[model samples]
Target chain A: MHHRLDALLPLAGAILFVMLWWLLALSGVIDPVLMPAPQDAAVALWKGFADGTLTHDFWQTVWRTVLSFVIATAIGVPLGIALGSSSRVYAAVEFVIDFFRSTPASALFPMFLVIFGVGEKTKIAVAAFGAALVILFNVAYGVMNAKKTRQAAAHVMGAGRLRIMVDVTLWESLPQTFVGMRSGISLALVIVIVAEMFIGSTDGLGQRVINAQMVFDMPLMYAAIFAAGALGYGLNLLFLVIERRFVHWGGK
Target chain B: MTSHSPGSPHITIRGLTKAFAGVPLYDGFNLDFARGRITSIFGPNGCGKSTLINMIAGLMPMDGGQVLFDGKTLRETVIGYVFQNYRDALFPWKRAIDNIAYPLVRAGMDRAAIDARVDELVTSFDIGFDLKRYPYELSGGQQQLVSIMRALAPRPEVLFLDEPFSALDYEMTLSMRDKLQEVFHATGVTMILVSHDLEEAVYLADHVLMLTRRPTRIAEVIDFGAPRPRTSATLSEPGFVRAKAHALDVFQREVRRAP
Candidate 1:
């Protein structure tokens, strides 16, 4: 009973949040034009999905984000492991990785635009660059800090260095790699949305949100914002599930 | 059984030298370990007991040394090692059974043969817990038991255990001790154990190798001939008591002595 109650707490909080927003909408302290009723926003979301216009935008954002994340993981995981495995190499290149990781992804926009000429490839390339750095640093640290005892155990068991790296070091870095991938996708989604909003784009949740704002379609704008939010939350949830499945013994 | 005479030692360490931050921990150290005997290393704190074994096991580099296993370098020898931190030593990503098979996998054994060997170990060890579960899912004793299984999987000629039961509870420690003794009896592999507990040092040892303070030297090597299968009852036996008392005496003298 206690566990069941604990599980329901989050649902209760969500309902309460919506109810508070509902009450505020009805209270008229703020302009109704600015803060539409929660019901209106819900109906708008339901209608947009029903009419199939918002579906295109939602899927577009999903595709770009997924592609960027895929590219980032491909580049980051192997590169990170290589850098992390060698102390000399890691020391030589640590500063560069840290510098880019600290810089905002948005700040690289003009540079990316110049290199890729303000099109589809530019958005994804920038997002992948940002996410890759996040993942690379995480995977590198993960490999570097893998438990010494486990490696020693493998060594004493008569494993060669290459075998130890493949058999032990790679598996040991898995949890952290998942962590990187999870956060990488979220950052990718953020970058993809920002790019869609600013750069010339025909469709996407970001484009829909900005388009609705210009046309004074508050309901559509709010609905698109909620869709983007759901996408982010869903992506995080997906990666979390994957992480648990792969690294079941993580943090145990 | 292999012949274990002083004239023909199984392992010979020549001029083993190691320094920590320019302070010598072991300098020009030479020692011999008899084959097919359980040797327990007991020493003062920071006396480099684990360090010495690590160097011999080729897990750590020595400043200078030649460690020969019956006239071969460490690379030419097959050995097993169990660590005190069994949690860190275990691969959490693999199932317990797979972890045991890991060494064999590295040895390039075929899957069918590996399965046969792993199954043999599971039966011989009389393991009750499910080996399908990962190491983190099991209790501490079970994890250490897995480590021991993994170590023995390769059929190593020598086994090194560094305080393998120090992290376990008293009940688990007793059971693990019995298990280790059974393994020793069955294999007669040249076994070396490093321990801080004097009673454990005496109880499990054919010879207790006592060491001095830093820049450690052999204080003494006391032979313990009390018959096994040693149990809790043996802990109070006259021979066990005598060995323990002697080891403790040497330990005190060395711990207080100037390095």
Candidate 2:
């Protein structure tokens, strides 16, 4: 009973907040154009669904985010592993990674637009760059903290460097890698949406929100904002499930 | 069985020296393990027993020395080592059976053969209660036994054990000793054990190597010519008692001399 209640607490809080917003709107304390009532937001979301506008934008956002995440994992995981395993390489690249991390992803948006132009490619580049920075450091930290004795034991057991990585280093760092990917997913979602919103785009959820705001369609804009939040929460839960399945030892 | 193979010693160490932070641990250390015999190293705490074993295991680099195995450099030889801390010895994430099969995975054995060997070892070691259980779930004694089986599964020429039974209770330790004797008798592999417990050392070793304190060097090498199939009766033998007394004296002297 207690566990179920704990799980439901967040949903309960969200419902209460929506109800409070409805009451505030009903009292005429805020104008409809400025603060849409909960029902108006829901109606606007439902109308978008019927017209296929919401579905198209949602799929566009999903594809771009997924592609960006894959690109980040492909480049970031290997670079992180290499830097982590070799002391000389890590020392050489440490300053560069730190600088990239400190520079905001938004600052690179204009550069990406100039180089790649305002398209899916530009948005992906921005998202991948931002997401890769987060995962690379995590991978380095995981490799540095790997057990020496385990590696030595594998060596004595006739494992070469590659085998040592498969049996020991990579396997041991797997949990940390999963954690890094989890965090990267969240960061990528944030950057991908922002990239889609600011950089020229016409079909993504971010573009829809910007379009609504420009036309003074407050209900549509609020609905899109809520949709983005929902999508982020859903992706986080999905990543958590993946983490649990792969690393059963690390309990939820 | 009385003499080593008609060649150089199975393992030969000469002028082995190791230092940490300007403090010398082993200086001009020399030792050898004869082929097909169990040798135990006994010493007072901080006498570099672990340091010597770690060097032999190739876990650490020696300050100045050479280690020869069967007249070959250590880089050219195969060795198996069992750490005293079972917590460190076994990977907590792996199941007991997989842990036992680790050596085979490293050796590039076929999956079927590895599975067969792992099954045999699991049965031989009686690790059935929780073959699928992780190391952290098992007791200290259970984990230690699993560690020993993991080290032995590879069937290395020379096995290095660093006080693997120290953490066990009295009864568990005795049973583990019995299991070890059974394994050694069955395999006939050379063994070297490093320990501080005199009785435990004499109980298991054919020859006990004693060491002095830091800047450590061998104090003495006591040979127990007791016949094989060692048991409780071996401990009561006159020579065993005398050797234990002598080991105690060296241990006490080292204790007094160490800062």
Candidate 3:
């Protein structure tokens, strides 16, 4: 009985939250323009889906996020492994990595815009840069912290440098690499949306939000925001599932 | 059985010197390990027994002198080292069978050959546990068994076990010792064991090399001429008792001499 109730708790809380919002809207204490009714937002969500505007914009944002994320992983994972494997390489580049990792990724947007000319490239570059740093940091630490005994065991078995890297270091760093990928993808989405909102974008969920707010379409604006949040949650859930399946021995 | 005279040294160590954090552990140390025999190294806590075996196994570097193998350089000779921490020694991600087959896989053995070798070993050891489980899923003794199986997979010329049974419980330790003896007899591999337990050293080894503390040296090398397939009864045999006592005497004298 308790298990069943526990499973329903999240749904119950969501229902209560929506009911409170509806009651507050009915009370007329707050402006409807600022806090639209839940039903009105639902209606706007349906209209956008029926007209296909929401679907197109959603796919556009997803494509940009995925493209930048792939680029980040491609550059960051190998670089991280190299730095982690060699203390000399890590020492040479440590200061630079720390400096860029600490600096807010948004601060680099002006430079990216100048180089890429405010096109899709600039938007993708900013997101990829941020995501790469996160992945690199995690991968390097993972390689550095691999258990010493395992390495020694492999060495005694006559494993050469390349074999050790592929069989031991790569598998050892996998759990942490997954962690980096999850956070990297999330940051990629955030940067893409921010770019769409502030920088010039022809069509995206963020563009729809900006356009709706300018025309005082509060319900449409709220619906677009909800869709973006749903996308993030869904992406995070996808990563969690993959991590569980692949990294079953992570905690062990 | 192979002849094990002082003249027939399979591995000869000369003037080995090593220090940790500027404190000397082995200063100009020297010894010879015979082929086809189980040699146990015994010393007090913090002694350099593990260090000595690691250096010989070429797992670590020696500051001075060199190790001369009978027929090859250190790199060309196949070696196996089983660490004290079996939990960390075995790869937790791989299943027990995979761990056993890791060395063969590294040697680029074909799939059928690898499977055949692994199956042969499993049949020889006669360990009835499921080999499909991950290392972490098995008990401590089972994991260490997998580690030993992996070490033997490469058919190493010399197998260095750094206190392999130190972490196991009494029952597990007994069973693991039995398994080690069976494998040792079957393969006749040159075995070097670093041990702290006096009785265990005598029970498992054909000869025991007792050492002094830091700045370590071989205080004495006592040989046990007991029969093969040592068992619980061997622990109480007169030969075993005499060898253990001789090792204990040397160990106490050396430890007491330290300032």
Candidate 4:
């Protein structure tokens, strides 16, 4: 009984949240133009899906997010390994990495706009840049914290520098690398959506939200925002499944 | 293989000196490990036995001494070190078989040869457990067995075991001791083991080097001339008891004299 209650707790909380939102809308506590009723938003979601606009926007956002994530992973993994393996390399780049990591990628939109010239490339590049820094930081620390005994064992077994890096260092850092990848992908999706909403984009879930708000289509705006939230949650769940499969011995 | 006499030195440590934070551990220390024998170094806690073996293994550089292999240079010689913490020593991600195959893989052996070698070791040891399971899934004793197997994988001329069985339960320790004795007899590899347990030191070793505390030197070198393949029954034998008592006597004397 307790286990069943524990399992249903999240669902109960979600229902309660929705109930509170509906009550506020029905009571006229907030402007209906700003916060549409739950039923109106549900209708708008169904209509958008039927018209294929929601599907196109969803796929576009997903494509940009995946592309940026891949780019970030490709660059971040190797750089992180190198930096983590060598103290000299880490010291050389630590300050620069820290500076970029602390500076919000959104704040650099104007600079990105000028450099990549207001296109999909600019938005993708900015998201990829942010994702890369996150992954690189995680990967470096993972490498740095690779067990000393394992490395020594490899060394004593007559493994050379490069061989040890591949055999010992790389596998040791894998659990941490997965952590970085998951967070990196999430950040990539967030940056891509923000970029779509702010930077010039013709189609995306973000753009739909903006377009609906401009036309005072409150239900459509709320539906698009809900779609974005679902997308983030879905992507995060996907990464979690992958992590569980690949890094089974992570905490053990 | 060039056969040296039973008492001939395999590794010689000359004029060794080591210090930690201005306190001397080994000052002008010298020792010789015999060829093709199991030598156990037993001392009190924090006596630098592990440090000494680490230096000899070339895992840690000596402060001023040279550890010279009798006929081969350090690089030319293959060494295997089984760490005390088997959990950290064995790669958790790799399966038992893969961990055993690691040193062979490092030696650039072909896949077929590596598999054959691992299979031979597993068969010779008569290991009954599943080799496909990852290290974490194995029991503590099994994990240490995997560690020992990895060390033996390279067919190392010298195997350094730093308190290999200290983490095991009483039953597991006894079983591992028998397993270790079997390996030693089969391979005749020169084994240097460091232990905190005096009985374990006397049982596993053909020769026991008992050390004093810091500024450590060999307080006694007691030889257990008992038979090979020492069993649990051997632990009660007259020679084993005598050897253990002598080691304890030397250790007590050394501790009493420490300033």
lDDT values, one for every candidate:
0.92, 0.82, 0.89, 0.90
Candidate 2: tens digits of C-alpha lDDT, residues A5-109:
999998998899998999998988888778989899999999887899987888888888888889999988998898889988899989999999889888999
Query: In candidate 1, what are the lDDT values of residues A1-252, reduced to their tens digit?
Result: 999899899899899999999999999988888888889999999999999889989999999999999999999999999999999999999999999999999999999999999789999999999999999999999999888898898888777899889988998898889999998999999999999999888889989999988887888889999999999999999999988888888865
Runs with alpha carbons beyond 4 Å of true place in candidate 1: A1-5, B1-8
**Worst 10 contiguous positions by lDDT, candidate 4 chain A:** A243-252
- Shift in Å, residue B94, candidate 4: 1.8
Highest DockQ model number: 1
Superior candidate under DockQ, 3 versus 4: 4
Native-referenced DockQ of model 2: 0.34
Encode model 1's per-residue lDDT on B143-178: one tens digit a residue: 999999999999997899999999999999999999
- lDDT string for model 2 (B181-247, tens) is 8888888788899876789898888888887778787777888777777888988999889988887
* Clashing pairs for predicted structure model 4, backbone only: none
Q: What would the per-residue lDDT of candidate 3 be over residues A58-155, giving only the tens digit for each residue?
A: 99999999999999999999999999999888989999998998888888999998899978999999999999999998999899888888888988
The CAPRI category of model 4 is medium
Interface RMSD of each: 1.0, 3.0, 1.0, 1.0
* lDDT of each residue in B88-162, candidate 4, tens digit only: 998888898999999998899999999999999999989879999999999999999999999999899899999
Q: Please state the CAPRI-style docking class of candidate 2.
A: acceptable
